[model samples]
Target: MSKNKAKKEATEKEYRKPLIKRRKPNRSIAGDIALYLFLTLVAFVMAFPIIYAVSSALKPLDELFKFPPTIFAQHPTTDNFSDLFITMGKSWVTFSRYLFNTVFITAVGTAGHLIIASMGAFVLAKYEFPGAQGFFKVVTVAMMFTGYATAIPNYIILNKLGWIDTYWAIIIPAFASPMGFFLMKQFMEGLPTSLIEAAKIDGANEWKVFSGIVMPNVKPAWMTLIIFSVQALWNNKASTYIYSEERKTLVYALQQIQAGGIARTGQGAAVLVVVMIVPIIIFVFSESQILETMASSGLKD
Candidate 1:
């Protein structure tokens, strides 16, 4: 019996030996170190501009163009920001108004795009109506056309509607986003039909099914759409809300700083840093929770 037990142990050890030998314990550690090194390098590369901007913004005016280019401010101060807000006076008030205008338009535009695009995509993906394919083809074609090509027509339409120099000129044109519809439609096609069918059998109407069943299942896609839409509109410089000085976006505001005079170079840097960093920080923090959920949820259907 003791001999049999010893033989069994030897057999088990023999079986386990191959797995142990095949396992490269240090390989995983090496891979992890390599990945971290690459990411650190990428982080530094991406962060350098932001770091430089912040340093420039904080540096004293005399040190702004000091030779050799300091990575850190020699003497940090908020004088640039203060001058931007206080010395500019009336221009500062206009800037604040434009900032608020941009925020409102972007938020509303993003929400509207998500709702309208999702609904349109749902119909296109699920229902087989007359000319459905043709309609989708038209949407695809529209997406292929650059916004610049339609800028003249859009300007004409806005002018015809007397929307020039108003918030509507900015917010209204953004409502019908072809790319957004296409993205939603593609995402919707991946969802299981059985979910919609089950909801229908349970006496849920199309609206109820779409809002409850469809939206919940595609949270990741929706979040992605929201992020993209926000970024696009927030950074937009074209159209310029009818080119009015008072009704410009943050981008236009920064442009004004340069147009006013290149002498305000440090102030321009401060404004640019503030405008760019604020949206990026907001987007990162807001989307982080959604991204965590998306990661844990896995890509399974």
Candidate 2:
């Protein structure tokens, strides 16, 4: 009877347990607060220029020229945008033409860069050739030299090719970006070799392997490359090769507006907002996607 009672007691104890337990966070509350504060501060510092532009875009002339410059506007107005369009209408060249040029250059340059960079990176990462190692090493070293360093040489080459003041001047030279190639090569390295081998076993040629198999896999990397290329080409002055007023990019036109004097501060601020919007939109939407893809790309079999 005592043993029977003991078994009953044990059964009751086993059935009386909770389904889940909550553990305390690994970090102390104070530490968590400090970390959040630091991150917030860093974000504010980085976003200062954008915040200033947005605020100034809404501010009146008197507030914009306030002795103690403020980030927040007191009175908001859309006069700057209105005045900007009016001035643009007076110009012989259409404002739409400037917008079209920027969009066209950015699109063509980005697409060509993606294709060329991906192909080059694929070869550098996967294919073994006599001088492939040396070539990739040279590319890596070349990235250390900024684009301005080669501006004079590029001007000479473009002049000789009869591409001066032409769309080709901007589009042609953009295909050879070493940074894009390097980024793609690194991302491609993380891909599984078995997939490529399996594609080959199925009678897929080099082009098929690169396009059908490889391109689909490293999407995040290329999407990231899109972000970089868009930002670069969107802001490009094309000042060196492009001499015609109508051929100038929206960025150059914005600079011209900003130089018109202190009276156009609000309009210049409006210009800044317009120039920054596209890249910001691209980044905000794709950043989470990039992180998720990078996580999955690390899985190997």
lDDT of each: 0.79, 0.85
Please provide, for model 2 over 120-163, each residue's C-alpha lDDT reduced to its tens digit, 9 standing for 90 to 100: 89988887889988888788789879999999998999999999
The TM-scores of all predictions, comma-separated, are 0.77, 0.84
Give the best candidate by lDDT. 2
Error of 1 at 5 (Å): 19
Error of 1 at 87 (Å): 3.9
For candidate 1, the clash count comes to 0
Q: Check candidate 2 and list the clashing pairs.
A: none
- What's the count of clashing pairs in each model shown? 0, 0
Model 1: CA > 4 A from native: 1-46, 238-244, 286-301
